[model samples]
Target: MPHKVIFVLIDGLAWQVAHDCMGHLQGLCEAGRASLYRLNSALPSLSRPLYECLLTGVPPVDSGVVHNQITRLSTQTSLFHLARAARLTTAAASYHWISELYNRSPYLAVRDRFTDDPALPIQHGIFYHADSYPDDHLLLDGEYLRQRHDPDLLLIHSMNVDDAGHHAGYDSPQYRNAARRMDIFLSDHLPGWLDAGYQVIVTSDHGMNDDRSHGGILPEERQVPLFTLGSAFSHAPEVAVRQVELCGLAADLLGLSHDKPRNQELIRR
Candidate 1:
């Protein structure tokens, strides 16, 4: 079988904070090709921009999702598009904006409904609000999607940590507890996915500062934790950590065709 991906995206999770606070994820850390990975989000470190960069492996200008006002991605080279080209099924769970990005508001069936563009075909997409859904519920939704579609690419985005960070401040117990609990929940479930032979990619879009807010270029805001587990990571279990461009990594994980460099082939390895 080919390399499938299960992506867990924790919002506003700083690399230092995730490493310091999320001990429950230690098993996954051990399962990975490296220890705590220190990586940079796209410039501006904002959620929307970083999401676009993640999908397209391009900067703000090319992705066409420069601000919060922009909901849909116009970039043709996005992971979704390339996944379609590779004939891989893709699914996602998270905020409603994600569904809106595919021009599907109100959730009228998130399976390959992009009428405007035939290239980007989403197998399934679920929308959840940050204030309402708990971390466990989000994980359940992701699991449900995984079982339902058996998608080749799965994206699980959680806002619990970011929401907690904003409401109680980044340094508060609430924020740390949020990350810890998320780790525990995923710790229980993620192994099953790995057992099923899917490569796991755990990361955050960006970090939060002391003010409990992001969208800045501060180190705390721009840096995020990146964890690669299963066979996709070829390095040793504890290689030297280094700075990485996250968007390119994401594109590579999904086997995006146009974005591949001549020297490196990710999905095959």
Candidate 2:
């Protein structure tokens, strides 16, 4: 059966921190309901660039989203576009940068923040501009979108963990607490998503550093975590997963044709 997917992008969450602090996800892995993999973020490891990479399967250098301030519509085809082309519905509760990339450019918060136009690549959206937007609110927005639209591909991007890492170091209590809080939120919502027949992939665009910033080559800045929870994935796969490959993986999960390379080892169907 073709699977509907809910992809949760937890911004700035590193492998170590996610491995340590996301106890609910970790418990799922321990119980064999999910699989965890180390994912290396695309080069330049910044939010906008990696976000493009995650959706387009194009590296930052190639996609021309080398920095966060580029603020324009994506030139490359994204997961949203591919899904829509395949006649699958798409929705997102994400940062405004996502709105800028896939839906519209120069996002007008007043008009674009809560979009539901079927003509758009993201057929439904609840976008936020602030980096400090609460993850709880974003998740709720995602759930609302899911229940209403029943999108085949739902993207939920939360920013609190990244915000906390920017305010405190990645090793600080605030950062860990942010991850823990998101874990609790996931604990609350994930079961419902799963029961609704949505295969879930929780991951991050990039990692965090002790300097409270990223865009560097440090492992802490490039090493993120990917947790796949659904029947479509292998219970144990040793394949190396890259951030760029996420687009293809998502496309594959949604039963769409994709040009990008997907880690087929990670899939059972």
Candidate 3:
């Protein structure tokens, strides 16, 4: 059965913090409405690289998007490409990096802020350049895109958690509050999304550290939380999931073709 997918990527949310602070998501798991799993992020644990890794299932070394400074369109086929190839509509309310990766390169704010070209991989987009952009606003941006285009695949990427983690240490109150805030926002939207028959996958690109940095192998930086709310998933929380498997999982949920490996244990027969 094919279903619409809404992927919420909360940037810089550590496993511990997300498990502890995101009570709404935890409650969903407890109530048997969602499944939770711990995922080991891709190598180096950097944002840009992991973003590419999660979307393409290709490591940074192979994708040539090893560092954040690499400002060019991705060479590898991504989830967006797969969705578009399948003739599915796609939209993203995300950071500029996403636009640069799948749509265009060297993002020009005025021209690229809002895009609606059906010819592109991401057929619709509302991209943001500031890290401090509010999570609530970003979610609404995604909602707007959804209401307008009704895309089969919609991406909502929030940045406040990552910004808070950078401004304060990952252990700081601000960082925790950011995750909590996002959870509250999700609570407001998840119910509607579920009722509307949209399968949702919420996860992060990478985690942050107590030193206000990442790009390391520390548990705080390498481990992240994955929560799946959909009928296609098993309501079992103990699945061994990995960051790169997300692309295939989404593709599977949407009935799209993907060459990447997925965690079959996580899906219900």
Candidate 4:
């Protein structure tokens, strides 16, 4: 059987950071026989737009999610919709409300909502405190969901690294420390899932620049890392992929046909 898929998005993680902290992610790459490539985020390079692109397999222009605040509910369908349509159990855990904003949960389930309340708006769905890092929370929730419901697809988004990068700069000690923490979390907690039968795909929405800001169109702001581990990937490609393709990689990984016109140019056979 094809292993279940776990998509982990480490927010604001740059290629340089991934390389610098290779020791943390190296084992996953080697064990799962994965490849590494640079993927470009959407224009403007914000979190919401890039994530919406990831979910809907559409560009920011097509998805109608250009900024972090504009909630485009009726624009396009998300990966969750496709997964649900296929009758696959799906779960999502994130540190930011943007994930919930783009991928809304049903009325009965828990929801993470954006708020100025500082308490981290929880409309019902498993909402972690905004003041705290939700990486471990998301991982534990994923494990719980897997054990109790055996969800076929799980999505996790960690934001501490991004927060640290934004506040302390990309190359600061805080940023590296946060990355290291994420490394430890993955190494210690996620290997069991891989052993049990799961294909883990770790990537980022976008990379941080030298000044730690990324709402612009630049190489650093665009290029992100892609690491696939488990039974779903081929031999690791030795060459670096320079093309600015984001949704194409995702579509390929999920075994979905690329329908978006812009992604047609980015798709690699």
Models 1 onward score TM values of: 0.84, 0.98, 0.98, 0.80
Over the stretch 1-269, how does candidate 1's per-residue lDDT look in tens digits? 45778878888788778888887566555655434566777777777777766655566665667776775535445566667778888888776556555435444444422222333455576666545478898889889888988888888889889888888776789888888898888887866897888878788878888897888788888878877677666644333332234445555665654643222322235
Arranged by lDDT, best first: 2, 3, 1, 4
Worst 10 residues of 3 by lDDT: 231-240
TM-score winner between 1 and 4, please give it.
1
User: For candidate 3, what is the total of clashing residue pairs?
Assistant: 0
Candidate 3 achieves a global lDDT of 0.92
lDDT digits (tens) for residues 1-269 of candidate 3: 88899999999999999999999999998889997788888887888898899888888888888889999999989999999999999999999999999999999999899999989999999999999999999999999999999999999999999999999988899999999999999999999899989999999988999889999899999899999998878766567887888998898888987798687787778
Residue-by-residue lDDT tens digits, candidate 2, 1-269: 67999999999999999999999999999999999999789899999999999999999999999999899999999999998988899999999999999999999999899999988999999999898989999999999999898899999999999999999988899999999999999999999988888889999999899999999999999999999998888866677888888889888888887798787788885
Q: Which stretches of candidate 4 lie over 4 Å from their true place?
A: 30-32, 96-99, 102-125, 129-131, 238-269
Error of 1 at 252 (Å): 4.0
lDDT of each: 0.69, 0.92, 0.92, 0.64
lDDT of 4 by residue, 156-241 (tens): 77888788888887668887787778888887766687787776778888877768788887777787787766655664455454
State the RMSD for candidate 2.
0.8
User: How many steric clashes between backbone atoms does each model show?
Assistant: 0, 0, 0, 3
